[model samples]
Target: MGNAYYKLNKIAESIYYYEKALLLAPNDQEIKTNLSYAQNMTWTL
Candidate 1:
């Protein structure tokens, strides 16, 4: 779901979903990495 939002260029939504996912699996490296990507996107914007 997060990835879908990311691909759609919905950075806020992607970050929201990624944060939600992180709550469930805090140690998930992929989610962390993806969330980092989304955050970086925000910085670029």
Candidate 2:
């Protein structure tokens, strides 16, 4: 779900979910992807 958001360029949504997910699993792959993608976009998502 969150990964899909990041993949589709919805950096904000991805970041939101990734942050929440981080509470449970900080090393999540999808979260990493979202963070990286957001970083690349320079949106701080």
Candidate 3:
């Protein structure tokens, strides 16, 4: 769900929901991937 948003270029909202998801599933791989990608987006900007 959240991953879709990031891939759609909705960075701020994606990061918001990703942060929420991380709190619930710290070991989630998809979340990690999204986070890594989002962080890279941050660095790029």
Candidate 4:
């Protein structure tokens, strides 16, 4: 879901979905990394 949003260039939505996923799996490093990437994308944009 987050990836879909990212592909669509919806960074805020991507971040929203990633954060929700993180809440469900706080220990998941992959999700954390994805969320960080999305956040960085927002900053770069």
Each model's lDDT comes to 0.98, 0.73, 0.82, 0.95
Better of 1 and 3 by TM-score: 1
Model 2, span 9-28: residue lDDT tens: 77778777777877788878
lDDT of 4 by residue, 1-45 (tens): 999999999999999999999999999999999999999997788
Write down the worst ten-residue block by lDDT for model 3.
36-45
Which of candidates 3 and 4 reaches a greater lDDT? 4
For candidate 3, list the clashing residue pairs, or say none: none
Model 3 ranges with Cα > 4 A deviation: none
Candidate 4 root-mean-square deviation in Å: 0.6
lDDT of 4 at 38: 93
Clashes of 3: 0
Ordered from best to worst TM-score, the candidate numbers read: 1, 4, 3, 2
Q: Model 3: per-residue lDDT, tens digit, 1-45?
A: 567888788877788888889999999998988887886797676
In model 2, where is the ten-residue run with the lowest total lDDT? Answer: 36-45
For model 1, residues 1-45, the per-residue Cα lDDT tens digits are: 999999999999999999999999999999999999999999889
- Choose 2 or 4, whichever is better by lDDT: 4
TM-scores of the candidates in the order shown? 0.95, 0.58, 0.70, 0.93
